[model samples]
Target: MTAPLLVTGAAGFIGMHVCEQLLNRGLQVIGIDNLNDYYDVSLKEARLARLKKHKGFRFFLIDISDRDAVANLFKTEKPSRVIHLAAQAGVRYSLEHPHAYADSNLTGFVNILEGCRAVDAEHLVFASSSSVYGSNKKLPYSESDPVDHPISLYAATKKANELMAHSYAHLYGFPCTGLRFFTVYGPWGRPDMAYFGFTRAILAGETIKIFNHGDMQRDFTYIDDIVDGVLKVFDNPPEADEAGPAYRIYNIGNDHPERLGYFVETLENVLGVEAIKEMYPMQPGDVQSTHADLTKIRRDFGFSPTTSIEEGLKKFADWYRGYYKC
Candidate 1:
């Protein structure tokens, strides 16, 4: 029997997709998630149900924050590679629940590092976010850009994760790769994301709040594109050199950015319902725009996001109507 690859947050939108792809490739997979009610528990369960259909996949209800449980799982499973994606995600929610960020993003990440060390994992591929580019006025965020100033607790935690991962890779002599994902959206996406809420509100004939008064931009990369890039990165680990440890960071995002109003209009068109828009002031801990420089990812892995906003939203809308029976 072959050892399984471990994936944290296996019930999550991105995690579920990654797990499914791995399973389809005939790889043994061990998935773990706490099933927290960060959003609707049913949705997570729905995702888990889909993965359960694959015989190559196994699951455990474990929280990454629990040090002992994580250590024990590592000792038992001894997975050669780990894809860590579980974390307390949300910018606005982080303001109200600051402790959640510290507990999950900070302490939980350390536990993951320890587990990797215990198993001598070949590579650790983890999720970072475009939020870490906070306060940077630069148009396109690059891997070499300075991310010292993060406006939200969520972004701060993500930045900290990168630093933490680098330190662990340096000390433990294990390769680590961090992917900084931009505004990702598609079918089975996070409900907290603006696009998801916008779809729901549009279909229900409710008012959709446009933050920053509809004056913002986002490089909304689709889910399939993200999964494609992730698998490519997972297969290739960085080589160690005299200058630093075997660690690398790349931005996985669509190179093109769309305006906020244009995005809403596109969504409205896709859902066949015009939303009642209400412009709102700039919210705290929110940036005006996010654009990713994908040169490194493209150069290294030949990654290119092919999904357009219109096409992606249409797929999401079709899934939404069918899933909700609306």
Candidate 2:
């Protein structure tokens, strides 16, 4: 068996999926999450309940910002690798609760870093976001592209994570990989996401807001695809390359950017319902489009996102119906 892994935010949407994947591969996992009610605590608990069934999995209800708790976890578990997914997410929510972002994203991330350093983890993988490519207007955002200007505090935190990881990689000779995930959606997805909200509104026969008059586009990646990509990267850690900073950043996204209207239409079709559309101006801290350049990941690690939106939406709809008894 390989060395055990530590996954922060194990009860979260992405973290839960990652833990499941790890357990399925017969890997030992130690998951940690605060179970904060950023959304629904029940959903987070549900994710934890599923992970508990795996004998190879262990969980701790510790907030990442708790320095002592986080450090103690690393000392006890001694996990060789770490996947830091715990963060204060959501762009709009960041505007309302700015301090939450600092506490979770900044302070929490620092705690994770200190843990990784103390444990001398083999590789550290953390979540980043496409929001870091804020207002680029570029067709395909690449790791090589500059990401200095972040529109929202959430995006800024994500970008800061990359920088923080890079500094550690350089200073400690630690191998760190930062994944800038795109629009990840599917079963057990976050309720705050647009696709999730859209599904609920359409089902309730409520009008769904169409920002930018549906002019926006996103690389709506599936949760499974994201998990697969993450696992692949986890298996292959970046070494101290001469050019790359002993740290690597990959954009984990669907290379195909689908129109917002088209995505909503696909969801509606899967649900067998038409959504009441409400046209609106672009909200603050919102980007018009996001397209990822997957060349680096594809060439180096054979990373490819295979799920199309139609097929993905159908699966999501099925899971939603069964999960919610809709």
Q: Kindly give the stretch of ten consecutive residues in candidate 1 with the minimal lDDT sum.
A: 265-274
Deviation (Å) of 67 in candidate 2: 0.5
| Stretches of candidate 2 exceeding 4 Å from the true structure | none
Residue 217 displacement (Å), model 2: 0.3
- Mind giving the per-residue lDDT tens digits that candidate 1 earns over 1-326? 77789999999999999999999999999999999999999999999999999999999999888999999999999999999999999999999999999989999999999999998899999999999999799889989999999999999999999999999999999999999999899989999999999888888889999998999999999999999999999999997899899999999999999999999999988887889999999999999989999999999999999999999989999998988888
Residue-wise C-alpha lDDT for candidate 2, range 97-178, written one tens digit per residue = 9999999999999999988888888999999999999999667999988899999999999999999999998888878999
Q: Runs in model 1 with CA error above 4 Å?
A: none
Residue 160 lDDT, candidate 1, scale 0-100: 97
Candidate 2, residue 64: Cα displacement in angstroms equals: 0.4
User: How much does candidate 2 score in TM-score?
Assistant: 0.98
- In candidate 1, clashing pairs total 0
Give the CA lDDT, 0 to 100, for residue 155 in model 1. 98
